[model samples]
Target: MNVTESEIIKIHNFIDLLNSKKDSIVVVEGKRDASALKKLGYYGKLCEFHSFKGLINFADSIASYKNLIVLFDGDRKGKYLTSKIISRLEHRIRIDLSFKRKLVTITKGKIRHIEDLSTYTRLDRFTVL
Candidate 1:
């Protein structure tokens, strides 16, 4: 499926949010998600949660960081994990849920996560979200 120009723009703006907060750590679903963000030129610190336990542990560890961004997949599992992580770390970290909406809307019925998005769209084509 082809991504619309507006969608690409939105994705770029999302990416820019990450870029602007260079010191903030980005939490994702898995290594693939991290890889996808990295391929998009996101060089900030990133942590991947392969499972619920990992996510909780990571959240606890990063409680000291004032800025934390969770960039999970748009699927059911991702939403569940996001909620859990937020519940665990909401006190100490700043969270951005905007990416979730943009990702879900852009992906529509095609892809479920960042890794899948990277697979379907070339990195160069991505602009400011």
Candidate 2:
């Protein structure tokens, strides 16, 4: 398939966002998600939370930094977790969910979360909303 110029630009923008916060810890869902990001060449620090309490604790510990990107999967669990996390640290951190565009896919007439964006079409021209 042909990778559009806009897709390349979007990928670069995503990479720039990741690299801009290389010093801060990136809070993600689990190892798989982190691994997928690493495969995409993200070299920033990654922190994985297995539970809500753990997530809270992690957020509390990093409250001093004031820079964090919550890169969770695009699913119900991820949305729930994101809401919980945002509620706790809404004022303390700068959270961005731009990566969700990279986790969405169309499956059997419905949009769903696959392992990664590579399973579907490249998110070249779409916005995160």
**RMSD per prediction, one decimal?**
3.5, 6.5
Compared with the true structure, the alpha-carbon lDDT of candidate 2 equals: 0.61
lDDT for each residue of candidate 1 in 6-40, tens digit (9 for 90 to 100): 66666666677677885577788888888888876
* Clash tally, candidates in order: 8, 1
Q: What lDDT, from 0 to 1, does candidate 1 have?
A: 0.72
lDDT of 2 by residue, 9-128 (tens): 555566557767744677777766666566656787777766335765787677766567776666789789889888888787877665555423112213333236342224533534
Clashing pairs in 1: 10-129, 11-129, 12-127, 12-128, 12-129, 13-128, 13-129, 14-129
Q: Which 10 consecutive positions of candidate 1 have the poorest summed lDDT?
A: 120-129
TM-score of 2: 0.65
The lDDT leader among the candidates is 1
